[model samples]
Target chain A: MLIFEPHIHMFSRITDDYERLALAGVRGVLEPAFWLGQNRTSVGTFVDYFETLIGWERHRAQQFGIHHFCTMGLNPREANDDRVNKDVLAILPRYCEKDSCVGVGEIGLDDQTKTEEKFMAEQLELAKRHDLPVLVHTPHRDKKKGFERCIAIVKEQNFPMQKLLLDHGNEETIKITRDLGCWSGFSIYPNTKMDPARMVAIVLEYGVERFVINSAADWGVSDPMMVPRTVVKLEQAGVPRSKIEQLVWKNPIGFFAQSGRISEQMLQQPARANLRETFDGNSVLRGQDPDRV
Target chain B: MSRMHEQLATLLGPAAAGADAEFAKVLADRSHLPVVFPGLPRRLGRNHLGGGRTRVGDATIDLDAFRPCDLAAADLLIRCEASDDELFDLYQHGDIEERTMLLRALHVLPVGPITVRMFGEAQRTNMLVHVEAALCDGDLFARTVGQPGFEPDVANRVLLKLAFLDLPLARCLFAERHANPGLSTMLQDLATEREAAGRAVWRDTWRMIGLAPTAGSAARLVGGLEHGDDGVRAAAAEGLLALGRKDLFAFAEERLPREPRADIRAILQRCLA
Candidate 1:
């Protein structure tokens, strides 16, 4: 079945990872804009990083037959920085309007600071203005409180639950968001977070309705192949193939398609792998013969 | 209507004329330029309005380097006689596309000291597209070429940055025409630095400096012709062709018979043509 990786940081992965993803039947990948494992000193870096997501990163993904899309926002971690927080929020409107930007994202509570809450509420409004969905990055440290605070900000902003994707979810958070009318996202990892075996258990219990899975792989020891691995475990767990396909593909699109940019019809097409085509005269070919490749 | 108004009206047809009027009403408030700028591309359609030229300070920069909606956004700012302060503020805070258009449209606006800071804003970006917008077509660097007053020599910095980013030198349409001895020296130094660092130098480094070849770059043009790489040979021939450096092209012409690559042969044939 074709899989849509809903949250992997392809920017942090190598080109071989993209090849691996394609060989593993992953069709499309959504790379949400997030911090690069550390705080950026300025908004200039944020703008540059955002441009990479929409520009070169997208070009790089297409070369490997992956349909790349991204959500643009200030992440939860950087929301507390006095230097870049408001400036990032200041520049996010235009980024939200970019064609490949499917949502405002990675923009929920991390440390659960009042400043984080401020920017989360602000970006929730930013998404509403752009008519885009959101991918909220709940805290890795205090994830339970992070999920609650993220949900509270979304609720207090009166943001539609249908458009909220509370990502980095575990079994405990699923219990919170499953009946809350929002999409719940699980990141299947190699060792930590939710492993494939654990994700299979979640799928068995949650039944894949309004549910999504991703690698959430980034500048860390994470697996880009976790989604495909989870599909295997789900298969062995007696989860039907059609339901697995729905979980891997349809559910993510159903949530993000609220942007009117992405659709089932969009990802249904083959990846745009015209190797000779250059973005500003730099193709991924780098001098390799396209035909031979 | 101004030339931009006429061009946009002609290109966009009735839809563009209506947009101009709609924008004119918003321009009455003036501050609405930033508020309405980002959404124009979606509202106006992104069909490139085609290449046109405008005097940005001392240089005529390509307007088609900008998107149609961005051109319209720039035109709106121009229509309101947007002061340098306003343009600076918009450019200071504009996102990727916004800043790119602002940089590319720098030629259409009146040149001043404020533009220098705006130039710094483009330089500050780690994104190549932003730098491309400024130097390649913004004519911001072209304005600083021999004219002086701009600091740090952005013309050379942008060309080297283009190499660092692996974007083509062709993006900067006037790179060869704007070629200067300082830029040639800078390009040669960069080539040496890359070689020492065990990195491949930019293919077009010699090409950009071919017009104003320093001793090192001039020698590279000769060496590049006999280089084992077909792409290098083709690039060397093309560089000589641009410079009308027939003496250098003679080497490629001699090696043409032995050249197996059809692409390189085509360029070599053009060298003596």
Candidate 2:
């Protein structure tokens, strides 16, 4: 089955993950710009990270036969940093206009702080101005309140609900998100987020219309293969092959393709994976001889 | 019980009859919707299922299993039964997901001045999904700008939005059909604005220049050769070469030796070669 991981932090993953993802039948990945674990003191670091997502990260993914697309945004966690938030917001438009940069995302409330809300609203405007979809990152703690705040902010901004992806959803949030008419995203992490069985149950109930499952895998203990693993679970649970395909592949392409960059044809085209590919002087095979591996 | 379930059940028809009541109850409960029937007791592990297994009950079966055929039939049913006014109302009020489905159904839905106006409004929102729903297939573009075509102002606005959104020109429905001097001028203006603001101009913007080459565009590309960023210079050289403007070849040849970066030099060398 051709899979499209709508959300994953491939930057935080090793090259072997890409190979493994390709082997697992993941054809495309949308890497939304997210907060690094450590607080960034400067906007330059954010710029470098965004550049890598669209440039180096895209190239690296292609070397493993995966088409890489990304969403550019000031992640909510960093929006609280007053020093660099403005600069990050200022430069966001430039990145958003890149071909591989598809949407404004991984942006929304983290702690539900006023600072986070302010940046979230501003980035919603950015998405509006750029004609991009939004991938909202709901707060882990006080999630119900966070999801409410997100819906409120989105309504206040008059951002189209159809253009919003209420990500990191759970049992409590899925029905509400579906009713609200926005896409619901679940991160199938090893722990913390919903697991595969839970995701399968959500899809079973929701009917997989605007639902997308992802491995919001990052530096934290996460699994990049969670999406495919979830697919396996869904199948075992007796979900039809077509529904599983829709949840994993069609749903994401339908969402991110709003950028006009992704399409079924584009996904079908096999990417050439040259393990010899290098970024700057760094190769994926650095320190290891390909012949031996 | 909900309007949504009613619509879904109506769309599913006889295929849904067996599980319709159970599906409705599942929708109604919201809470305590079982992942597995109580007697089944499938040992749900993280990311996968483990030991304890039992028969999957009809009540516990994924309702989405009936989706593919239901959705296709629903689209057809909507097309045949829904009026333009009905479609417009639904589109205007539908949630993002519903609106997206409506937009995708545009092909079967009617296309006229009213629908065209609706699509134009969606494009204006600059919301990726809405615009994509309206434009991804290039049908709206074809109808608006390719057929009898929109007024020049409307056409120019659509082209500029496509470029501004950084959408691939190839995916655009009538990019070639609507290519005009006015569109080229708009692209050049955008490039000028980016250069003045010290912002990186989109590569597609350069492509627009190559598509509609001008003396001004060539000069701008030549100036790009002297730009500080190696990528800019290389892109400039590549654009010029792609345009096949031999007049700029000499300029590139002259800059080749002075070009500090090997990558840029290689691009310049290819231009001369």
Candidate 3:
């Protein structure tokens, strides 16, 4: 069964473990530009970060035979900084057109402040101006307010709710996002966020429509393998093979492939035996034994 | 109202008029505003986990909601009410420091009867607090450390350096500690000891011993430790010993009391040791 993890931060992951993920039936990942381990100091940083999200990371993932795409925006964590936010908002237009960039996103509120609401409105406007989708970051704390504010801002901006993918959603937030007709993403984190068992419950409760799962792996204590692990959990929980494929595969393909970054045609390309060489020049597979047919 | 105030009032409303004038006053006079009723008294926070709302005039604001902000252009800014304790929690947790300080200042600003006709005293306090609080912890730390009347600044700098170890700027100041020969010598010795320790992470570093050239590899690595070649048996024993595989300790003690080969025997004996 093909699985798509629609919101993992692969840039925060420092490993060739994407190869392990690829072997486990994960076909694609959509990373969003987030605050690094620390907040950045300038707007020029957002431009460079956007470039890397859609640039270096795409090539890095291709080496493992997995497709990589990204959504770019000023994260809610960084939006708290007025100086950096001002600069990032100014530079966002220039970066929106990059090749593998999917949409303006993972932007919303952390504490649900007026500042966050202001920036969220501006970014939603940018997304509308560029005719792009948005990935909304619902705060881990004060989630109700975050969810409400996200919907309110989208409404205020008159941005279509369908173009928004509200991420880090819990059961409560997911219901609202779904009711608003926006896509809902659950970040399958280790302990503090949605775990595999919880995701199964969400699927059982919500069904799989307009739902996506992301690893949301970052500099914090999180696992990149969580996507495949969740897929396996769904399998063990007696989830249908087709439903699994839809939530983990078809839905993400429908969402991210719209960026015109990675297409079905590109996915149809033969799985290169020499993926490392075909993507990056370095060969990470030099001494490894191949599968014996 | 100032000319700029009158201009903005025509654009937005009477609401936006005196904001610029209040901001200018704050810039001209480097003084802090006073605390008002909306603020949680500094002592009230001793037991509370701090998830409460305070009203700034009619606007209800939460304390924890105060995060970092952009204070470069304070004219158009509207500061939210927040407490110092609440702001400190966010700052310590990596919320931008400048904004937290701004929130702290907002919480402590003195409430006065002289309210600008357009905006109340609380609103004025919020605006100015946001501006002044824009200085981050690093900036504040440097200022406090360098301020005159603080003894020599060296001892305090070292203490501040330790307190801010997690922050990158603190590390730079720590590097400058080398200019002092006394502190420099102690730090150098500490560095040398840390280096000589080899810094080998012990926990999982040995997990791959099964894959390495070891006796354990003969069994577990190649899946033939129980019934492999003689060389494999010997390797498994050596690997088991290296891995500190307690499960195999009894077997090693009885089955292969000691390798007849002096080299192998010494290796196994040392593992037990």
Q: Tell me the deviation in Å of residue A22 in model 1.
A: 2.1
Prediction 1: B-chain TM-score = 0.79
Q: What DockQ does each prediction reach against the true complex?
A: 0.09, 0.01, 0.01
**Candidate 1 runs further than 4 Å off:** A274-293, B2-7, B17-38, B47-273
Q: For model 1, what is the error of residue A21's alpha carbon versus the real structure, in angstroms, after optimal superposition?
A: 1.4
Error of 2 at A107 (Å): 0.4
Q: What is the C-alpha lDDT profile of model 2 across B1-273, one tens digit per residue?
A: 144345434444554443343334335543212211110111111111222211121111122222323233233333234456655654543333344545644533435555566666665665555666566543446555533336766767766766666666555544555655566678788878977988666555554565566548888777878878665676677767777878778988889889998987887788778
| Candidate models: Cα lDDT each | 0.77, 0.71, 0.55
lDDT by residue (A177-289, candidate 3, tens digit) is 77777788889989987999999999988899988888888878998888789888998999998998888878777776655455657665423433323111333445553
TM-score of each: 0.64, 0.52, 0.49
Task: State the lDDT at A74 in candidate 1.
Answer: 89
Among the numbered candidates, top DockQ falls to 1
Question: Considering every candidate listed, which one attains the maximal lDDT?
Answer: 1
Instruction: Return the number of clashes found in candidate 2.
Output: 2
lDDT (Cα, tens digit) per residue for candidate 1, span B111-162: 5665666666655565566777676754555555544446446656655677
